[model samples]
Target: MFLPTTVEEVERLGWKELDVILVTGDAYVDHPSFGVALIGHYLLSKGYRVGVIAQPDWHSGEDITRLGRPRLFFGISGGNVDSMVANYTASMKKRKTDDYSPGGIGGKRPDRAVIVYSNLVRRFFPKVPIVLGGLEASLRRFAQYDWWSDTLRKSILLDAKADLLVYGMAEKAVLQIAQTLEKTKDITSCHGIPGTVFWTSQRPENGIELPSFEEISQDKSKYAKATALLQFWTDPYRNVLIYQKQDNRYVVQNPPQLPLEQEELDRLYLLDFERRTHPYYARMGTVPALEMIQFSITAVRGCYGMCSFCALTHHQTTHVLSRSIDSIIEEAKMLTKHPDFRGTISDVGGPTANMYNSKCQRRETQGQCKKFCLHPAVCENAKVTHEDYLELLEKVKSVEGVKHLFVSSGIRHDLILMDKDADRIIKKLVDFTPGQLKLAPEHAHPKVLKLMRKPPAELFLEFKRRFESLSKTLSKKRYVIGYFIVAHPGESMHENDYLKKFIQRNLGYHPQQIQIFTPSPGTLSTAMYYTGIDPITGEEVFVERSLKHRNKMKQNVNTNG
Candidate 1:
């Protein structure tokens, strides 16, 4: 069942007051893929009366006030994707449409959406405690560079004036927050929860202090140092309370919440989701994002690939968590019963398709190592395998009503080459993949690839050769397409030219999935973008900040296609 979106619906449910209210920037689609829906259903199962106010108008109190104030607090998210990225393109021009909005409208959500919605809620209920979560709040919890404004910005906790902020996948932290508010009735008292950050006037004892916001704003080197420190302290088992002085007070971030165990992850997926947009928004039009992913299955969460430009490393962490195959098959069976059932299941993988069931004992005993699992080369400790995943694909495909199952998630081609059973895994992937298989080899230059913490260009070329050979042997006319990033830190016109030649000569096509780098908050590449120095090694790197130059590189790469 869908959560009540209006007062009339709330009344229809015969509930006098709601325990928690979630406000978001996207049209509410009650599917597990949507963050608000997953969180709302999780809270509801825990016996909290939850409601959602999605895409509320920031200009007035009408839509914001419809749900009124919750008995506990208001949880704000800028939808699944960050609002700034959703509203603008890499070139900083406004986008034409948003897939998450009803009818795929462009301006349904405002920029800095979490801050805007929090302030709007405060206008009507000044006394109600406001809590912030989702990608915008999670990434912006510290002072970082903003690409759109082209300036350093303070933490969203201070700017939004929110009482607290929850980072990472927040199932555990949010439940604790709800329970604390119910018992104590004071938001400030709800500190010391893992996966939460709050402002405090007093200095916290036994906490590591990051460079002050004032210091980092003025000194680029200091900012780079702080970014490195944060990444180093991300392990939940070994991390301590870390604080940063913003101005008059300190922003204290508790240790990260540990990745949920298998059973916990399995239960979250089995929640009651309608798997469609609510009728309230459906009357407007269909959401294009839901249409693409409604049939897909999220078999895993978190990724070990610490690519410099990707946010999954910071948001989901470097530890991989996967659900049991029995749990996954059960969900696939549920899809067969849906009224919108088609024989095809669009996807059946997670952050990285092949990372499914990949585990290392060192992570449990010692926490994340400074060395990456796949980068440099696959570590000996990195037990990369595909036995369990191959079994999963076979079982899911044999389910009664399913005709085709595609592994649409990103696959780490480098891992496939390292696996002992590479031949069998590649054959299985070919059977499940649609016409084309996509691989993200960001650039061809070795220096740039090193700065991005990706495998050397030679590895990608070797993997492409093997994949093509296997396809030909199987009589499958499938093509391997490459994705590239332009103007990342340590990349320039010379590097872009090198990438163009590599694509034309080796890939034999002007690959279409090209994009200029945007410096979002809390990413290693963004740190390099802001500082012009690689954080890994304290050496200066080149960055293309000029919009004209960035656009020209993209255009040059796409010339022959």
Candidate 2:
């Protein structure tokens, strides 16, 4: 069932006030893919009256007060991305479109939306417990670097004046907060909860101390050092509490919550989701973001690849948790019944599509992994197989009214090479995909690939050759659509030229999906961007800071041969 949004809807449910209210920058979509919807529906299963305020007018209190006041707390999210990153381009210009907004509207959400929404809620209900979640809060739980302002900023909790911030996937933590607050009615005492960050009058003595806001703002090396330490402690099995002073109070981030086991993951996906945008936005126009994921299924979460530029490692951990096949099939069947279902399922994959039903050994989770799962070379301890995923796809195909199923998220080329029986997955996808299987090679140059923590250039080359041979055997037409990020740290004009030449020699064509790197918080690449040095080696690196040069790097990939 959809969460109650309007006061009339709440009244119709025979409710006086909501237990929790979620304020989001994007229009509310009642699908498992959207974080707010998953959490809202999950709360409903726990018997809480949850309401959502989607992209409310930040300038006024009209929409913010539509659902009265929440009894437990106000949950705020900057949608699926960091607001500044979402609203602005890498060159610091406003973006013309926001897929998450209704009608693909831009400027619907203000800059730093979590901070804005939390402060707005405070103006109306001064005593309400303000909580932050989603990418903005998760990545900025500690002191972070702000690309928009080109300055280091304090933890988002201090800027937002929020009582608490829950990072990572917050399903388990949100439930704990609701139950604990319902009983104690004291938000300040909400500490020792996993995956939560809160302001404390007394500094948390047991937690590891990081470079303070002032220190990070003053020294680049300090920021780099802090970023490495912060990432090191992300593993739930070996993390200690982290404390960093933002202002007068300390922001204490509790150790990350453990990944939900397979059964628990299945249950979360099996929750009753309406699987569409809240009807309140239906008349405005289509939400472009939904078009990408309305039919797609996220069969897994987290990534073990641990690329330096990617945030999955820092925010979601690199354990590569996944859902059960039964749960995925049931969801796919439900989609056939969806009103918009065209007898096709857009995707059934995750951070890495092939990683589904495969995971690290028991000892791999005891602490942080010492090596990347697919970088340099596939780790010896890594489990590489695709039999279970192939079986799941077969079950999905057998579902009545399902005409087509595609793994559109991405197919890791390196993983494809690692799997001894990679031909089956490639053959199936070549037949399923119209012309291409999406792959993120990121860069073709070795130095840039080293900075990216991705596999070497030879892997993509080998995968391409194998793909050609397999497709020739079937007499089918398909190729890899490579995604590249240019102007990354350690990548100057020299690497861009190298990338241009590498693509010309190997693929015989320039890629279309190319972009300049944006130094976002909670990424090792961003740390490198800020420090102008490799965090691990402390060696100077080339960082492209000029807008003109960065723009040139983007164009290098689009010039077809």
Candidate 3:
């Protein structure tokens, strides 16, 4: 909660008085890379007075009106509302036929019609010039296949009735939109913004004119395939297009940066830390917990681990960069000043947490070599060492408020074990980590592992044994292994059975997590589902995880444990 300041003070900041209000369904204030905080900061930087309405109960219209109405609206989302609705709708059908529902036969509509939090604001205040952006909006920018409904879906712009849709990194696009709205008050005029998409009302009725996406030229084949699937976008009826009104044409702008280079990564981290810290700490009357206690820091912007079943790599791209150790140490110092600051640092890494300063180095002529050179299989490169990472951990642990520092992020076992310096870092992590360590060995079978492009199950077992031994010697807490995607394409019953038996024999039957496989849009798995052939091998496969089967698997795991 923020202290009440006079509206005059807010107006003196050169912000317009109450023209727009940004609403969100996320609980946390600083979501690191995601959520409304980043955009809110960007808007404030552009001289827009914005107030965040976090985690509002959308079931009641009265709850929404408490923040006061606005001339324009911004809604932000974190991919939960849509998942909840899908789960609710599915469960209702399974209920006893004779049971009468008290809330009527209809589902609860969220405050916003679109998945992005911004679009939801438009649902309550229609014709108020709404703008939607975030992960939900970014991924669904163009017509794409939705596995749950087994149909195509249109861009969220049409479905949410938002005036404009911003994709990828929201900072630049959001600032541009705020500046334009403050000047002209017309969203259509701001269509040419680098990372935004909007309907051209003046275009022909048969097909809408879409702005040429810069990425489309670089990756023409991918764009062509994505465009061809446009016709498949449909609602539950599988007839009416999900997003209608403008001709079916959609534009997907080039995201701010596809794969951030080392220098860019450092710049983003430095700038964000500087901008977000002071205001955030001052508003709360203490340093934010995210800075000190438990928060994730992105050491690298994108992931190179192109796991077929994972979405992070597909959307964020498969490039890696490491932030400077100096920047990380400075940020750690800032976290120590929080009033409720915990002694423990939850995580000190990014996407694949343990990957720090690990880059492919290529020797060139004239005795000069490229620093942080990205190789084809960068993780497996010999020169990419973890000495810097070990030094980084040591520096963070030396911070005044930080009593115990732990690495809670995913560990790339193969990368850690391959390099001697990286292995030393892993050894230190295991010996010093406070609580349960988390690692995602997504699958056990070699076939499944290969499909995921992950290291073999044997390697994970080896790492687990090594960690367990180290933990016992150091008297540390137990470790938890995260195994996900039970019914991915090409997974056989025999493979699952073998995996279950392997868990029973090695790590005991009681596993902490077993997540169901969800086929996210724009992944390698989705491509396989569409073409009915494995994208990597072109082999035919079968995916057989129904709701009932997933439930049964959970039950079986519990009973076996």
| Clash count for each candidate, listed in order shown | 0, 0, 10
Predicted model with the maximum TM-score? 1
Q: Write the per-residue lDDT of candidate 3 for residues 1-561, one digit (tens) a residue.
A: 121123443456555455556654443244345346566655554556666554455656554555566545554554322333323323224222111111122222332335534444556766667777666666666655566666555666666666777655556667777778778877777776655667644433343223233333334343334432331221111222222232434443332322334564455554332223224224423323334324445565545565666655434434455788777877677667645456766778776765566543422111112211222233334344566767788888898878877776666776776665544555687755656677778777777766566677777788888777767776776575756556666666676776677778877656757765666665566655544455544566665547676555544554573
Cα error, residue 497 of model 3, in Å, equals: 0.8
Q: Can you list the residue pairs that collide in candidate 3?
A: 75-117, 75-118, 76-117, 76-118, 77-117, 112-120, 152-232, 152-233, 152-234, 153-233
Model 2, 64-92: lDDT tens digits are: 99898889999999998889988999888
C-alpha lDDT of residue 90 in model 1: 91
Residues forming the 10-long window of minimal summed lDDT in candidate 2: 362-371
Instruction: List the pairs of residues colliding in candidate 1.
Output: none
The TM-scores, one per candidate, come to 0.98, 0.97, 0.74
Model 2: residue 381 alpha-carbon error in angstroms: 1.0
TM-score of 2: 0.97
List the candidate numbers ranked by TM-score, top first. 1, 2, 3
Instruction: Please give the RMSD to the true structure for each candidate, in Å.
Output: 1.2, 1.5, 8.7
Error of 1 at 238 (Å): 1.2
Expressed as tens digits, the lDDT of each residue in 365-465 for candidate 1 is 56788887887888887775588888999999999999999988999888888877787778878898798888899999999998888887887888778
